[model samples]
Target: MSTEKVRAYQPETKPKRKQKQVKVKVTKKKWISTGEKYLYSVISGAMLCACAYVISFSSATDSLNRDIESMEGKIQEQQSVNNSLSYEAEQLRNPERILEIAKKHGLDIKQSQVKQAGTVSAD
Candidate 1:
């Protein structure tokens, strides 16, 4: 029951090389139904919400990906440090190197004082 309507075309006519002007009127279809208008508004709102969600999701995903890369780099660095420390530990545990350093300090190992490992006496 809406009285409002839209004009399809309006024309302005003027006499060629003369003093005359005319206005022409054209009538078009009337306004759409209330249900159609409501449908249009609802569709527009839904589209807007969908676009906003996509934008927010993409930005958040990008930030999380950056954090993952940073953490991976830190893990690699720590693993490298751990490997270096392991190598140093290996060098320190060498028996020949330990004995060489002990000799420098004038420490001697007597053979009789050395007990065979895991040897058991029945007594």
Candidate 2:
């Protein structure tokens, strides 16, 4: 039994592995040759350009809106000025005001002077 146990218990030996130097081959890639990569770059550039154009257009639209608002305000102000000027013109066209202005300008018309001026004088 001891001999059978000794024969069954043969010492274990580890297998030796050989180490070799491995060379890895790396390939150089051209900038335009890879289809998917080039396509991705082109699509990305197009997306960026589209975004920039949208941003610029939005900014221009905002500027135009602001200008429109400014013009509207100016138009309102001008309308108010025109209303006041029209009121002033109506007041100036009043006969009493015209008489006062003529008096201030040293132009006086007596009733006799009007009648004398109305009569035609034959020379």
Number of the top-ranking candidate, with lDDT as the measure: 2
Q: Report lDDT (Cα) of residue 17, candidate 2.
A: 84
lDDT values for all models: 0.82, 0.83
**Positional deviation of residue 104's Cα in model 2 after best superposition, in angstroms:** 7.3
Estimate the TM-score for candidate 1: 0.63
Per-residue error at 55 for model 2, in Å?
0.3
lDDT of model 2 at residue 100?
71
List the candidate 2 regions with Cα displacement exceeding 4 Å: 1-33, 100-123
Model 1: lDDT to the true structure: 0.82
Pull out the clashing pairs in model 1: none
Model 1 segments more than 4 A misplaced: 1-28, 112-123
Error of 1 at 52 (Å): 0.7
Worst 10 residues of 2 by lDDT: 111-120
Q: Tell me each candidate's TM-score.
A: 0.63, 0.58
- Candidate 1, residue 15: lDDT: 58
Model 1 clash tally?
Answer: 0
